[model samples]
Target: MEDIIDKRMVDQSEMSYTVDILNKGVGQVAKKLLEESSELAFASVEQKSTADIVHEAADLIFHFLIMLKATGLTLNDVSEELESRHKN
Candidate 1:
């Protein structure tokens, strides 16, 4: 995903939806994250199929990564924080 973002940012010739969304800026990305998370939560509450839940979860994680990139952070950064908290 990081590679996709970097490549798309450098080469505009390719049509990548992820890049398009990222280009829309953090506000849009955050909105997607919220939407996806809501869908996931509602799906869980509605007792949707396992596949449906997984789909929503993937969407949420995708937007989450985009948010992290926009904010100049990474999964490692989040992991480090989690590790520190676990040790406390």
Candidate 2:
């Protein structure tokens, strides 16, 4: 799945696509993530199982990567920031 995502991202990048396309894609992904997160939050309030929360969290992370790619950033950049923050 990651490989497929990477390939699509590379193809999009190589095509010199417009920022609008990226923005739209990111916006949609953000909406989905927000919805999922809200559901997860509500589930927490209702004392739902950890498994459900974990599943939603994973969905959020996956969408986050799509958002990052849409913004022309790579996972490596995010990883580097996390590493730097860890050092601090």
- Best model number under TM-score: 1
Tens digit per residue, CA lDDT, model 2, 1-88: 3455677655775553233345477777677668867877787788778998788777667666667776678788989999999899
List lDDT for all candidates, in order.
0.88, 0.69
For model 1, the superposed segments whose C-alpha errors exceed 4 Å read none
**Candidate 1, residues 6-72: lDDT per residue as tens digits?**
6776798886877788889999999999999999999999999999999999889888888888888
Worst 10 residues of 2 by lDDT: 14-23
Q: What local lDDT score does residue 2 receive in model 2, on the 0 to 100 scale?
A: 45
The TM-score, computed over Cα atoms with residue i paired to residue i, of candidate 1 is 0.89
Q: Which regions in candidate 2 have their CA more than 4 angstroms from the true location?
A: 8-24
